[model samples]
Target chain A: MENRVLEEWEIKEMLSRYGIRVPRGIVVESLPEKLELEFPVVLKVSDPRIIHKSDVGGVILNIKNYPDLKEKFMEMKRRFPDSKFLIESMERQGVEVIIGVIKDRTFGEAIMFGLGGIFTELYRDVSFRLIPIDEYDAREMIDEIKARKIFEGFRNIKANKDSVVDLLLKVSRLVTDMGGKIDQLDLNPVIVREDGAVVVDAKMVIIP
Target chain B: MFEHLLNPRSIAVIGASSDERKIGNVIVKNLIYFGYGGRIYPVNPKNEIIYGHKTYPSLDSIEDEIDISIITLPATMVPDAVESCVKKNVKYVIAIAGGFSETGERGAELERMILDKIRGTNTRVIGPNTVGIYVPRSNVSTALTLPERTALPGDGSIAFISQSGALGLLTMDTIAEFGTGISAFINLGNRIDLSENELIKYFEDDEKTRSIVLYIENFKNGRDFFNVAKETVMKKPIVVLKSGRTSEGARAASLHTGALASNDAVTDGALAQAGIIRAYSETELMDYGKVLAYQKPLYGDRIAIVTTAGGLGVITADYLVSTEKGVGMKLAVISDENKKRIRDTIVPFGSAENPIDLTADGSTEQYSRVLEILNSERNVDGIIVYALFQTAKVDETLIDVLEDNMKGKPMVVGILGSKMGKRMILEAEKRGIPAFPSMERTVKAIKVLYMRGRYLKRRYEDGEQGS
Candidate 1:
């Protein structure tokens, strides 16, 4: 079966269905008259073909007012004429970590947790476990990383470590339910704050 | 399940020869030399007697029921030989030949033929391209490797399972020098029937085996192996030295998770999650195995260093806390009361801090007293004793002190030097005390014990919650 990357909005909908917290967002073909969400929103071109949306200027962050959101949405619509636009709430900056799921050829479905953004590839500080992990396994994944000190109030950042553990178990259950149909799922830069954790961006590749 | 295979009462050596150079001859000689208590039937049509024993012309000719059969013929002739063993209702067959599935497709077809002959019967195959097994307690050694270099180190707790015959024999050959012995060693060449998983399950329940060590290049059935390993480790610690860690062995992946998931990284994580310790090299494999087998798991990472030389104590302390090579252990704190007790036994110049230094004038009596205090100390989780024999007063009597102190806390001795010192190290190992040549090795071995301890604590806590 051919693999396809799910669109940004589709991934958010899937995450919410699995009880994972994602930024409140809407996918619109055209700019609406007024915004229902709070000000300072994120505008992005929701196209499945775009794997690195920020690299191609498909994402515009921090629109302060309604006119700015409308202008940014129109600009993104023109840039990718066939694609829809996602307007999301700009999340508060917090501890950034990446959580991913991949169908390993030998061990089958496995989950990965690491320092998110460029650090995910730069330091390569990640830990993995075969899916259907327990609370202990999730906790170990968090502690195994070299940069694990980040969760324990690294510098100015302090994250709710328990929320990350909760996120891991929920994702494990989600991947376990999806089974062999899901090839890969990446929740990059999942902003883990003192209060809770949110998946700021999600990318999924499925066998269907 | 592998009673006949492990400790056979009677064995038939098919294609057994009188020539000293042949593998067949070596098999028969090893059995007799190792004092195998069972009956031995040498089967060869051309010879009436081989190795000073009456030989049978064929399996049908032997009146006694065979518990196990060793086929030392070439790969092409293995099927017919297995066919005879099956017709005779032999329980197990150890096919010691080189050519099989390891060669190519045609060889795999030949292997399948051998498998087909023993499909419904009681017979099980060990290898068509393997060295078979060695059980010291049963006095059975079927390895084709030379007896002199690959002499079996008499019975001990570690059960070693290797995928490569030569590597397995080499490790076995050197383990004796390290003062470690194997309860059993089975080489899983081509893995037609018995693989590491089966051997692991067998050793888990075996009273002789305390810990299991594996040298696997690639798993035969990875998922099944993982499942078995997950359950087995809760009972006993399992250590693996899996080769092919480089990126060259990695599969090209399109997704980020797959891209980051290199062969070694995934293996490292998977093994850890299952509570199986991974060793990067052969030395690490044996070192981890020996330590896990001999010592009880530490309760925490806090460690105490007892040494005759202050320099050795300092070096050990450095390694104990070294971020890169260390396993996150700290210099154990001693209460003032315990510190005064240690001080009263040692010389005037000796220091009584975390790395308790006994100075060059330290005697075996001092060591005995210090170790006794440390063993009773609540702050210390484990102890690394630098049993330097080069000192004036420290002599062979220190080995006795180490043995006596071995009961309460996990202690590893670091001793290295002339022939006399090496013998002392071996002596300690024979007594089930882990002793190494260098401070680095001693610290690394302690790391393995610490890892096992941490893993067991989590497993037990989870179990308690469940119940």
Candidate 2:
């Protein structure tokens, strides 16, 4: 309660309370002798101390088999010995979106949504609203951002509006339910496939 | 600190001079002319008497208790004046002199000297290089004069807090022209001791304050500000006009108020999260404030526009509906059944479908019918009436109809011509209704009201969860 920041797993648990979908994932400090997941899984260092896993080469994606997974896991451990690891099922890509909450000086806990992955930082297209956004407000925040046009079917791909709205609503509800306990929560690269959406990766920081 | 600043009864004007050009002289004149009921003493070592009132040579010589002392002396003399006021146990001091921290390092040192003098004492200082406060209700005008005495001195609903003294003065003048008064006006220049967040917290419990407006350049404490704003907004509407948003603005702000400006993205995100309406311009700020301050909060976002002209009606309706795209609110005009019934009862050719455009040949009776139908319609949450006041058949009769039907519901009137619209505008204001000069402003006001209304509803619902 003293810290307002939530860890990644805690954020996932909170989002689960709001009925948000996330990829099947499990946390482990050490690599298991026998891997349970199928081929083409994604594994990343899940240490709360590490903010950017890809920067440190802690993320190993598209592992085709068990040998590849073992080799990548060993490499990741060798590179970062103290870091915890998370094994998650790789998700199919349709559209990528980033959703987070940033503590603002003038306005309080602001929820943000934008086009995700590299486009999010490169394009810097995002929309924000005050925390505890209702269902209507969540829908509005999604539509207000410039990246919303991409969600309305960009180029040849037909955009999934329902999934985008659903994601925003759930995120809003998550932030609302967490109240002042959560400082910042980032769910990047939320894969919005034709049928549904799943959060592929997340980072949460508790304020001390 | 803000409470002591705003509610001070007895005041002393330092650097009191007989010359009208001096800041001290103007402040004394403003306080006296504005009819400050409390005792006003002039303190000047040089002048024996200022404006025919006996001036005290020093704070020690003054026998009466001073709740607030205004320092309008030179930069070098400010420390001594503050020392004198502190020794006299003055609770609040508003330093109107310039050449403080805003100047440079040397001036900043001098500003620190002033702050050091009042550090732990009960005495709180407002500004060392700033304009001062204005409480029309108390008839306290401590700022430098501009010719805008149009603001009525009564308990008003809007409270304005600005980082810039000049902008605060300008806003006072501008809002006065709109015939709206303010409960309290403050300029928190440099915010050396008092900040916007503290003022907002004070306003949260203020019964006289219905809506709060701010012109902020930077936030000294972002997290503290957010927490207070989030809580305060649940009590009253908070509208912020945040300047220094762009890179150039940030640089300029640093020079203006010594504000370490943050990135625009962070500021925007923060404002959105706080549920505070961020206005782009002074005009928009006042427009939003007027709607939030005067009109009753709307129950829903569904607006029913009633216009005399088809083109104007269409434009109004379009703007109202389009603005709510992201907000997910709907605006539909009165239905055909209600429209036809109104037309048959009032005007036979009035067009249906929300806008309820009565053709050019329509009369006051048609306007009345449209209002009656919209009032009875369950789908309509609010109404906007656009009338061509210059038309031959159109007269005060439409105003009368509006006056009768506009009770317990929010409605805005847009008069076509300014010259002929004055009478109607006055009448509307007298009736506690807002009348805009243009269709664009009318639509914008309605949109703000709708947005604010929705936010308020959400805040209340969220509050219930906590209870």
Candidate 3:
């Protein structure tokens, strides 16, 4: 709401509004005497202008206890004095997939799906569909990608296909609800476990 | 509105000449040789007669209303010719000149002048920098190529549109050679008056066009064209082979979404959204046209390949099953009942599997019998019949049985190699079955049929079909 580029928390809030589930996160403006939460949490810097969080030493993962959390938190605070930070529970390891939306000038709203996270950058394996996609189109898009094999599970994991389909349909609906204000949206590293999937990270760019 | 362009009743050849080497001479000669069933008025200031037709000094000299005026003159004189056409109430103008837009500033200025002249008038121009159109049914061809170079089209269901004139005609030659006919061919060089959007509507309105294929470099108005394509695809499949797919943005892109989704990715997505099938090559475009023009869109991906040879069927099975999961089609599991029928009908040693091999000993009776059993099986979405005429037992009779059996079902045919094979393939095509010389091409056509079916299913589910 304050800037053209929405930060991670803002994008997550937007996703929550569209019925897309994101990992539980809390933005801490001030450090308390004691942090009350489970271990194995992720802390990421919240900044609308910074596009890549990990590249800038802004993302800290796997702090097992309060001492480690506070130590990493203070280190990050010392590194960037003015930036806000968000701490959330780290999601269980699952198949990571990328779901995105790009407003094509020819066709109005186009959605993209593929294997997500760093490998998405390395391999560039992606598939696309126009918005207002139905359950059938969602299923087809899920099946169309080369990385579709990831959804079938690997190494003692079961396929979480229904969750992937639900996510795609929600993304499709989100594109429609954005009403053309949404220029692009990326939910990279969406953890898909056997039970369900969650948006581990999200970034959206409006008309800027 | 483009009906006159496709079915011009009378034409005036503006630079008609008697010299053999001149473009005007070749156009006039080509028109006469093709048996164009229309009145031709040859206009030339220098000649009193051209090819035995009485030549007038100008178009206004003709009393009849001119439907089209073919101008083969210098770029500077094109505007004046259009002025003449406007006065004559010419419905279409094919400017067979090359110096507009392609030759830079001065030529672009001349093109602008022609555009200025034809504004708010009935005169619609095809090109100022290119060749024109080809309509097989009407025998109306405005391309400058003579009889020796390009074979004229036979009447068929494909309506082809191309941005490049020469490429369009050469594609025409290739497709015509492949035993498919074109309903209409439009060369849209320097599309001054008409672009693809309006022509798309024109092709959609024409009941004769069952499928439309396009060769595009870039669109004049991409969104506008896509909107029209969305409307047309449910009724008739539009296959496009788009050029100019360079990874120009990959270097500047900052995110995986941006880098992975190239211009072509966006284009392909747009095309898919519109339900228009995109072909990667001209041959695939033609092959898609052949199947689309003849058969109905398949309802499923379960294909039943019936072949005389085992190797062809094996190869086809590989391609169909080798694709990614969603679009990957399977060889329909031939029911035991149908297998028994094949055994009862064909030789006992002949296989009764999905690729029901009639063996090298297959004859017309066996082909028809296997086709009947397959046709009766509801599990079979489409069939690919391979007729090897070289087997010494098969003859021209196979074509008759094939045309009869394949009438209502979606299908393609593959014949053996050689002159005999080409003849049989063309023979089957003449009777309205898409026949090819190789299994690869035939299976590819079948794959297109399956893709069309999937698209139709998606369209119906989306309810855009009613729109």
**Best TM-score goes to which candidate?**
1
lDDT of 3 by residue, A30-149 (tens): 556766666688999888777788889899998788778888889889887888899988888878888888766555577888887677767767777778776776777777676676
lDDT of 1 by residue, B61-123 (tens): 999999999999999999999999999999988999988888899899999999899898888
lDDT of 2 by residue, B1-467 (tens): 35556666688999888988988889988888888888889998875677678888888788988888999999888888899989999988888888888889988998789889988887777876778889977788888875454343334678988889888887777666545667898888877777788889998888788889999887868778777888888778888898877763332110101121235765775666677888989887877776777777776888777776888877776676673532334676566677668668545566676677777777887788667778888778888888677667788877778777667478777876757786677566566566777887888777777767777777788678769
What lDDT does each candidate get?
A: 0.87, 0.75, 0.82
lDDT of 2 by residue, A85-186 (tens): 888778877787777766654555667777776666666677776666666567766776776767667776765778777887777676666666556667
The per-model DockQ list reads: 0.64, 0.23, 0.43
| lDDT at residue B213 of model 3 (Cα atoms) | 92
True contacts kept of each: 0.50, 0.29, 0.36
- Candidate 2 CAPRI level: incorrect
In candidate 3, what are the lDDT values of residues B174-202, reduced to their tens digit? 87775688889988899887888888888
Instruction: Return the lDDT, model 1, position B147.
Output: 61
DockQ winner between candidates 1 and 2: 1
